[model samples]
Target: MLPPSVFESAFNSSPIGKYLLSPTPEALILAVNDAFLKACSRRREDLLGKSLFVAFPADPDDPASSTNEAELRASFARVLETGTPDLLPVQRYPIPLEGPDGTIAFEERFWSAYSAPVFGPDGAVTCISHTTKDVTEQIRSERALRESENRFRALTTAGQVVYRMNADWTELRELDGRGFLRDTDSPRSFWLQDYIPDDEQARVHAAVGEAIRTGRVFELEHRVRRIDGSDGWALSRAVPICDAHGRVVEWIGAASDITERKAAEEKLRESDRRKDEFLAMLAHELRNPIAPISAAAALLQRMQLDEALVRRTSQIIARQVGHMTALIDDLLDVSRVTRGLVELERVPLDLRDVLQDAVEQVAPLVQARRHTLALELPSQATIVVGDKKRLVQVVANLLNNAAKYTPEGGCLAVRAGAQDGGACVEVSDNGIGMAPELTGRVFDLFAQAERSADRSLGGLGLGLALVKSLVELHGGTVGCESAGLGQGSRFLACLPCLSGDTAPQGEQDDEPMAQAPAALRVLVVDDNVDAAVMLAMLLEASGHEVLVEHGARAALARAHEARPQVFLLDIGLPEMDGKELARRLRAEPATRDALLVAVTGYGQDSDREQIMAAGFDHHLVKPVDMERLEAILAGAA
Candidate 1:
């Protein structure tokens, strides 16, 4: 027989409530801690020896009962009758209990219960042990975990590959089978001894070992081999599990199979590097036009109004701005293409107009290089409806390509004539022609025929490829035909034509020069030897006598001999800057009457104000335009 003392001792100290039920299930003997009393809304004496059915009855008339009283009785009855354990799915039963307010509150509570039969020596059922646990939060957490896993799986599977690594780093089990990857590591190890590349294994091993030892999560990317014997890429991370004693037991981690992603990242990085190169090219290309445009703007600002000259200057501004916009747009367009989102604007435009505009754009280079350019156009108008800008780009690319490959004295011929139901434009140049192998890959992105560090040509290989893509976008095809090495090359563009109106005449007429300013002894000062020489040449061309000085100190010494009426000083001069030089020149009695102009590449409004405030009479930015410069000289005289 079980000792009564043992039951009493358990009754006093137990956390869960225990009750001795009477035959009628009315009043009951309560054995519980304060939590149980609170759960049932009762005291010890009120629950003692009362029939269990009467004291804690299911509401006879109410459909909703307090504690699964009927279910509990049924479970208890089964345990008593059969002495067997009954398993149940999780169920919720309200406590039929309330706080001091008699209202349902946070602790008004529900319990998920389990009952077992405790047997005596004769195998008769002695008492039932009932256990209740609050599972509200646990259930919620489990559901959230499942939903989150589903969501994470969805995102990773859509584009990037996701994998789950086992506790040991030995296996990289696939989570998704996208099969899009770039494998750089050897593919023979089933992704172990050879999955990570030789150069990367040491680093991978270190990170993984550190993570496991410290029980910390680990993350990294490494070259991995794929199943196909081709190398690829993978990014992985791991989480550690700890025992109750705070010792690490196991780890669960996720990996993303990133073969294509790796390739794309490498490509993007290359693109960024190319953009940096382009910006450098742009800086150089920009200088070519900026000197003239800014000079023109400054000259236009000061000159008296005449419609013809004003129109000419305005056209110059529009053209230069358009060039800058086009270059910037090239960068944007490449970005769009790589991101898989390039749109086309289709419109009917005369192919002749595009060719003419492109020719005119390169006219300055033609004259500068002393190259003879011949244009052959069909008398019959050639009309092709497509994107006008892209058409212009195609023609301009041909011209640029010609200029780069041809010698200074080479001939560049542009022809635009009607072909078999299509418009054809061809550009041919003579210089050092392409080698057969080079010609085959001329249109490859970033392809360069000559990439020796000291090669003379300067291009990133985007121009022709961009031209090709743009032309193709407009329903046109472009091709290049070149004789072997030393033989010149010709680019042919063919666009399907629609019988339409004649092409408009682009601006091909030249504006009359701004007449020469009265001659004056001028002094030009700059630290950059090339810039000062170029300025002096331009000034001399404008009919002014010019003297050069390398620095502010040199300018001060040369001022006495030059007896100059005007001085152009560079702001970024070595030792002393233009501002100080201008001030020092003004202090000299001989130069007091001389007009001081600060010439520099700094065009910010604030930079101008600072120069003007520092005793310079005028500020000029570099790449000086001849007309504006002439006006500056005229105003000073």
Candidate 2:
């Protein structure tokens, strides 16, 4: 055992604060060492004979001080009653200090305390020994760490793809993708290869190198491999995290899924490109017919020629005009069909008869090409419910394509029969076939194979598109197959077959209507001077008194004066259009009963509706069908 003097020396020189208090309920302070006096900022004489509570009074303003005081007193009481040591918890215990101005202020502090009972000779507790150590700096450091961890959690929980990378970006330390990407929890050296697509990895590598060299933020819109192994897009950004010496330690990054937005942008770009191509093609097509027509007209006006030569020149003009008109008609037809404006006239009919009509329409083209045509039809009648005219049109278009694309002396076959519970019409040709890429989208609008500079195989690429649309409108399907270029191609159309009923008998052809022989007064109005005069001349050739007017106002005045029985008015006129003229003519007593007809270039359904609503009795698209117009005039006569 140590001597009494040595034990007292150790207690007084100890770094921890130590004190002794009487073991009574009053708990009066009996002694204090040098460390205790220094810690409390008090002298030994000031505390010795005073109660422990009086020496360390609780601060009313500091709530933690009150708690610390209660805990210390409880610990001391327990040591006295149990005659054992009691370890106190770490707590905030504020101390009062005198400032330079003699004002007392409380300094915030944290401490860990302990108390033990001291036994006397009689084996009874004489006093309690207390020790305290300051722990303020450690407590404050722990609190700051907790707050940092909470902020990190909040960021990861949001819909952001947070990631951490090594200083040079050569390694991926961690990643929380939040479902937008694949998560990485461990360091990876092959992270770039695993996350980025093969074609896009080089670009990512270049970006990473630049960001590392410059110590700048990295930003890129790039492709990524999704969790399901599908291709996706992301807008990624990473900023350099620096150390105290201004050296980059790592990268903190986030990414957003931009897959849907990128797809929409690509679609818009493709649409714009296609529209520009279509406009250029339209200009080329229009100029082709215009060149020949202009040349023919100049030859007729500038030269003296024989009757035969003059007739030949006129035929050239008429043929080129017909070709131009056909091109316009195809454009309008496709537009109407795609917009769901065409209505089918569905009727039960024999498929054989429909095929026969289609064959007749394409017979001229086939003979000119010197192609051998073969027809394979079923023995019995194949009945189907469809529009006979549209069905004929569909077959004719397919057969025409075969004739146009096949070389001279090629063979073409049209086969029709009942197959797969439906009526199938197959058109096959031993001709130049399509490439693999072209076959897939051949039915799309304006999609076509490569054509020569002269465009010898003349077409606007609307035939197959129209065939597909019309077949689908009849609740059927159409498909094409080819064995590469120069082999062969086949087109198949399938339509639902009519069952459990006999085919309806074909309707008899209508007799030709009788012509009106008596001369009738007629008025023709048009914005073009040539169109008005030519129409007037045609009327006079039929023994009718004809008046020509160049505008709507002139036509209305002429009709009122002539009291004409027939009126052919153009829809597009200067200052006043044909529909308004028709309405104004209908209001006048002199021309109210006239057979009003519309002659215009506009032929859409909406245009037709407007014409009819303006009181016109007949609507005709230009160049007017002379036979139909004659019929209308004959009915009026």
Best by lDDT: 2
The clash numbers for all candidates, in the given order, read 20, 0
TM-score (C-alpha) between model 2 and the true structure: 0.70
What is the TM-score of candidate 1? 0.39
Model 2: per-residue Cα lDDT over 118-199, one tens digit each: 9999999988988888787678656643443333322223344677888988777556655433446567674677778999
Kindly report which residue stretches of model 2 are placed more than 4 angstroms away from their true locations once superposed.
Answer: 1-161, 178-185, 197-199, 225-233, 241-248, 255-272, 449-454, 500-502, 508-518
Question: Cα lDDT for residue 111, model 2?
Answer: 83
- Give RMSD to native, each candidate: 29.0, 34.9
**Per-residue accuracy of model 1 over 251-370 as CA lDDT, tens digit each:** 565555555555756877967775566566656656756777897878787847789888888789768866765555555555444333445556667676788889988888777888
| Per-prediction TM-score to the true structure, in the order listed | 0.39, 0.70
Q: Candidate 1: where are CA atoms >4 Å away? A: 1-215, 226-232, 244-249, 258-264, 275-379, 384-397, 407-422, 428-452, 458-637
Question: How much is the lDDT of residue 55 in candidate 1?
Answer: 55
